[model samples]
Target chain A: MGLNLDYKAELDNIIRDHIDMEGPLLPVLHAVMARFSHIPKDAIPIIARKLNLSSAEVSGVVSFYHDFKKEKVGRHKVQICRSEACQAMGSRELEVHAKKSLKVDFGESTNDDLIFLEPVYCLGNCACSPSVRIDDEIHARVTPSGFDKLISDLRSVNHHKARNS
Target chain B: MRKLFIPNDTSAVAMGSNLVANRFEELIKNKSLDIQIIRNGSRGMFWLEPLVEFESDFKRFGFQSVDLSEVESILEFICDDSFDAALNKHPKFLGETESIEYFKKQQRLSFFRSGLGDPLCIDHYSSLEGFTGLKKALEMQPQQIVDEVKNSGLRGRGGAAFPTGIKWQTVLDTAHSKKYIVCNADEGDSGTFADRLLMESDPYQLIEGMIIAGLAVNANQGYIYLRSEYPFAHATLNTAISRCYAEGILGQNVLGKKICFELEVRLGAGAYICGEETSLLESLEGKRGLVRSKPPLPAIEGLFGCPTVVNNVLTLGAISTILCKGSDYYKNYGTGRSRGTLPVQLSGNIKRGGLIEIPFGISLREIVEDFGGGTFSGNPVKAIQVGGPLGAFVDRDKWDTPMDYEAFSAINSMIGHGGIVVFDDQINMFDQARFAMEFCAIESCGKCTPCRIGSTRGLEVLDKISSKKDVEDNLILLEELCDTMEHSSLCAMGGMTPFPVKSAVELYKEDFT
Candidate 1:
């Protein structure tokens, strides 16, 4: 794939502006990913070259963390809590429901490129039980039905945004 | 003007604080009450979240779990200054949070500022004695600051009790101009909510602690590797950071000095292994939270191969208090080397499943029987896990063990992040042990041979033992494998996963046999 020069420059500025001075290679990587949505496979070489580190070193750090995505991510990400606390609150059932409704398992995105579903540990909302985060917004006490409604709402919102754009 | 504090923490919101907040707004509009509602963080009394605090003179009256349906009565009752029996704030229902034996026994150093101020407001944080530690650290030489922490005997609160001062001094002594301070806020441990609670309740305290650490170690940049689970905490912390920057508490010569420290929050995709410091560092770099071999240790060459100081949320949170109160004040609380109050999280099958801060040396019996009020199901207590999923299980026979670091270690149990999980008599020990191995197998980063393969093998052994397939031989093999993992694993993932399994087998051998 052809690299977008402007996008790469913006990515470079984000790394330089937010994370260049930090010693550990990971925070810079996190900053880059946070800015660009996903860690581009091509950018790994650039990062390795900038930090005077080996490709293995950069790739080691990248592969060790579950958060870094090599491929493109959907605009909205949905993470369901699969930790013990959430499990005790029936997250297992909720997970099945969410998967069925989203038509994707954990770590997989829908064909529409709208929502990406994944499993998370505890979100510290145990009291509410079965918490799910739609992008940055955490929704608690989420039933399978509630998750379906949320997905529908997100789909509609995305559809609306697409029309506007 | 009538001032009200509605804690906007997840626990409070879970208990319907958002509904109560909206109701309060509606009541003000309809009744024209001269009241301003401010959403703050939880006060650690999680059981009583949606806790509405109304200011009267200097004292604040609290109402626990106030829902929208009861807001009218609550507002009316508060306005009249009459104790409403229905609203549960009457003298009969008003349980004094401070006077409650659970709250009374806690020293509350790290959690001192939590729930006492608006985390979003810098003025409130300042009024409540926030940033005083950063100011004190800024005035002294970095070495002197490090010396003070060393003397205070503060250890990492993230399971492993490594001394914070030693780590800082090592990083400081290391010849590196480019050092980084990474705060591990990936509190994925099931029962441990202290890190999350501190982050959501008192964001500025953590920031102050990080800034102080940065100033002490001469590092200009810091990152809080928070879990994706805590969206509210992430949002609140970001707001707190913005407010700090606006108020000159962070970034560019903080407090009119030449010390420049910038902080950012990095979210981890929900992986349990990321709680490990090295794995956390790896994840912060946008990698999977797989463990790395030690020897270089994060202090000498960490982050991007420069010297770095990686600490747990509670360990750093305790710094501000130690700096403010002095080492002597902090040292006077806990027993022996475990000298400080520990913010113990009481969870699982307990009547009072909430956060409690207590001085060290307190017996597990007091916490379990006295404070916890036994199991919520009213059954006899069978086994209690003092740490996280990986922590060992202590049966009723060993309930008298003191909660100090040495005491737990003496009994072959470590106070891993002070997460106390209670299990009633109805719980099956074999099932629990099986679950522990299963949890390890599922969450293991699959980096090393011992953890990746050993955990799966361990689970199979546990299954055989539980299912009575050559139960005795399987039990022996399980112990042997646990020993190998404990000695040879790269990190605590395999090292500590055996804690629950071994302890369960040792404590409840009958279940396995």
Candidate 2:
């Protein structure tokens, strides 16, 4: 986990890039999170100082949103739609299956750190109910078997990469 | 060379449209055939997505729900000597995509170019009378532009039925050198995807609309507050925005008119309340999305305390149509006070789910049964939750009511964002009521007491009713709590949550017992 990265220099660059924009804090945090899997604790004070806000205010915003993760998550983030449309198409069962198959509940990463499951409200693909987003790709009409195949395929790819390395 | 159209829209991609498109590319490569594959936006017939269309001789025919196996057969069918004979022989053939009963019935105004060709192609957009609206707007005065929208009778399509022209007029009249035009692209309502569809399918339409709005209000800056859930729309918008800058459609000289306007997309951090204008502004400022009070409306002092013209994606998207084809042409389509077309999204356990851009005043029954084609499970239609989560769970008796603002209000329901989520006979009304309260609690923003705390109490009361513990008293307490939230809560999040709960209890009394 120790990569000997320069946190202060990277934070300064992220803050500097977005500082001129109208609403710079969210974009800065988003850029930071994109660079580092999560918003590191030390980066908050730096962001607050750069944006001319207090540390409490910065952390308040970071804590308010569900998207801004404070800690690192699994390599692949898997989101399941739990909104009414998905529920109408039997996503409750899919949710149950996802949890059972992944061996973890919502907001928890798998023991192997392969996948992180989270309950998303909606993905705007209501027409194709029971939608799931794995990494960046969203899959519609996801059944238990469909989800299993996706996870297994992801795992197999990871395994192949590990073996080759 | 014949062209093959496959949708690259979110819904289509979810249904394996990408794989189908890639497979076609591979097959064309292997066979050395003279074919073109165009990734267009969805036609909104989502149930038949991955809908492959072949265009030859200026006619477009479709193949519904095309998987890898069907792709091979489609290639064979298109290569036949005669299209009619080949289409007749094929099992998946859906004759002329435009003539399909679902697409034909819809009166498309804003979505005219959807699924026609590449959404990003400026030439394709131009061929279909795309920037004609902005061209028309350039010659007119600010008041003239505002008057045209007012005459069109276009209301805020993002749930509130407030007139769009009036909102713009307020911003235009307000003395501010640095006003802003914010497009609310946060389409968080569960049963809705219209905003997403407009942004993804006809992005230029939205860009054109924003530019028109900027011209109308004399505002030079705009921001599209997009939700994090819509990654696809985000990508499409960034591409479109940059393209506009490169093409001289946006920036210091818009369309070479010496007018200046700049637009940028700001992403929301998974907060449903941000769909509310005030919350959206707060989020744009890089703060927690807390709702601001109303006395100073967004049009007067918004986005860093400057006058802002905040309109929904569809509301702004409609501006292009209103400007392009005079207000009279746009106004002639719908009934009563609700003039112009509404992009209605039909979803959730529906047999034929998609986007139906029809005029207002059509009954819920028509939209749910006629356009939706009833339940996906082939079960009896028991309940329909029109207008997203805050909307009421209307029963069969209420389905006949016309789907306009006043008519729905008369029946204790609302056409919020035009999202209709259907449920079959198997749905439990009581459970839905509980879920409504739970959702409200989770997304309240914690600025007010009723929404923040009352939703939790409402959930507990419903739980007590479920457990059969003094049901009558608990029901009375629940009604009182709903009354408090309705009367005093900060915004619609708490104010209108009672709409669904009260309607469900009143309509389905048996479920309560």
Best by TM-score: 2
DockQ agreement of candidate 2 with the native complex: 0.85
What is the TM-score of each predicted model, taking all chains together? 0.86, 0.98
**Candidate 1 B-chain TM-score:** 0.96
Collision pairs in model 2: none
Q: Write model 1 residue lDDT over B183-275, tens digit each, in one string.
A: 999888876788988998888889999999998899999999888778788888998898888988888979889889999988776578888
Which regions of candidate 2 deviate over 4 angstroms? A1-5
Q: For candidate 2, lDDT tens digit of each residue in A1-165?
A: 332358778878889999999989899988987888788888887899989999999999998888889999998989999898988988989999999999999999999999999998999999889899987789999999999999999999999999999
Q: What is the lDDT of residue B403 in candidate 2?
A: 82
DockQ measured for candidate 1: 0.30
Model 2 clashing-pair count: 0
lDDT of 1 by residue, A1-165 (tens): 335898789767766764544454666666766777788877888787777888887887676556778777777888897754455445778998888877888899988888888887666765445678787677766788888888889989888998999
Error of 2 at B208 (Å): 0.4
Candidate 2 root-mean-square deviation in Å: 1.2
